[model samples]
Target: MGEFSKTVGEQGENLVSKFLDTIGWVGAQSGESIDCCKSEAHKNPGTNGRKTHGIDFFYSTKSQLQDYTLDNVVMSVKYTDKPYPSNPSTLFKAHLKDLAYTIECYMKSDFRTDNNDEHSMSGIKQANDTGVLFWFTNDKDSDQDVVGKVSTIQLEKSLSFSSIYLVDNSRAAFIYNVIKYVRDNFSEYSFYYHYTFSSANYKGADNERYGIVFPVEYLVSNILPFRLINKDTKKNVFCLASREQFSEESINRLLYLASDISQDFTDEFIFLFPEYDPLHDNKVLMKAKRLVNAKNRAPNIKVLAYNNDFRGLVNE
Candidate 1:
């Protein structure tokens, strides 16, 4: 790779590493070389044997919400200076194939065995290998949804691998903006990811109520619910960061949802949307508040806006 290409790649990897830190996927092993399983090496007809696969980043962690399960995530990052290609199916397919091959080799490689012993916790029954592809661009328009563009592509039946997740520019933007808003506005309070129905509710499960990592469900959730608490004053704030634009109906529903999930100790509720203008939304917001208060639901909820553009966090 040329110096320019290498620099762009490093930038993307650094951004992803910081994001992983925010979500509590820390201590990842990067730039690893894992020996290719013979099964994979034999499939290729090349004269010279390809003996190793490169892993951009790898992490293994016990699931906070899933009982007795560990998640091993393999990550691949691609950063470009141009907008997404007009026909992205070809590129998406190639990326997926490469990642799938990496996962296949990783599952059988000694690197995985050695790390599992180091990272796996007690009582874990099964470990799942997951692949995550972070494909992004630094173009003027960096908010394109790459997943939607490739959603229509049909995978070949012969192509087999574990679950894979794609983080397009837009998805990453939503997650980063949420982090920026919280850190900028509520830097003092303790952050906690709220447990939902998806969390293991059974006794003796590792369903930690306080953690920096988000349950996988929240990655695609319409609303990301979390909490903040000031230990000094016992002030508890429950928050929901929504992906959609501000809407009266959505606010009303989210208020009720927050009320249902929020603890009695919660002192306030904050709802974040992509954009909320008081000049146009104040009346509706007031009406929603009144209705909720009339029903004796959460009355302390307030609405605000957050940056949805991916580029907004360039300096962050």
Candidate 2:
């Protein structure tokens, strides 16, 4: 496949899109169904082939009222290897106009899609509260120094959001790429979900998506399994249950989650934490863990104190 001749920044946007989906963020396109971990190469379609101006990657709650999950994170992905000039003024102006348009749409309730799926003017309202996330490669150092100044410009102009962040890469972001990379390299690591096409119910339905989890049998047949890879070894031997709360029956559901996988996982290790009470329910968890492993389906179990925004903690 020939790669698109996109700018370094455009390439960065594509990378961020993939990262977003892996971390549970769905892409927001004008007239298409939102998908996770899907990448769209940039192509100039405007006057003189200028890159289109709008939300690079917009995410929200997966629930029915899928609105803006977070304010626009005008991504500034820098390529340490490229000789591109750092133009803060140009960057700020572009993002500000983008935010302005976004706010304008929200005010008119026009952000809602024709399918009424995502960014339905539910999560974001104003630009003052939206922050920008900057990503840099190893060589593009200096925090770009102008970031602080640009952020002030954003605050002064919008009076809405003034948050700024910089990261070479987050663990969650790392895991996001690793899963796909590994899935591509090995068929053993490959997994897929089977869902009948759906677009009607918005209760738990994602807009214009194929899978809606309708049939009871779909529980065991279609949903994708989380392949929690150990960062050190780059292996999915360890798994963590991220749910916050769990009742007695919930325990059975959790057990079946790991066991129901089509692939054999007798050697997998699963960890979880009770919702409100973080470190408190080992006895109960152990009982459930034992029941799951009783059939020689043996998978290690433990209670975890999951901290940070990173997905399934690496058991280092």
Best by lDDT: 1
- Give the per-residue lDDT of model 2 (tens digit) for 57-90: 4433333223222233333334333322365556
In candidate 1, which residue ranges exceed 4 Å CA deviation?
38-49, 119-121, 199-201, 263-267, 308-316
TM-scores for all predictions: 0.87, 0.35
On the 0 to 100 scale, the lDDT of residue 133 in model 2 is 43
lDDT of 2 at 275: 37
| Whole-model Cα lDDT of every candidate shown, in order | 0.78, 0.40
Local lDDT at 81 for model 1: 81
- Residue ranges of candidate 2 with Cα displaced over 4 Å: 1-6, 17-53, 58-61, 64-134, 138-158, 161-168, 171-173, 177-238, 241-316
Q: After superposition, how far is residue 306 of candidate 2 from its true place, in Å?
A: 17
Q: Give the TM-score (vs. native) of candidate 1.
A: 0.87
Q: What is the total number of backbone clashes in candidate 2? A: 6
What's every prediction's RMSD, in angstroms?
4.0, 13.7
Taking all chains together, the TM-score of candidate 2 against the true structure is 0.35
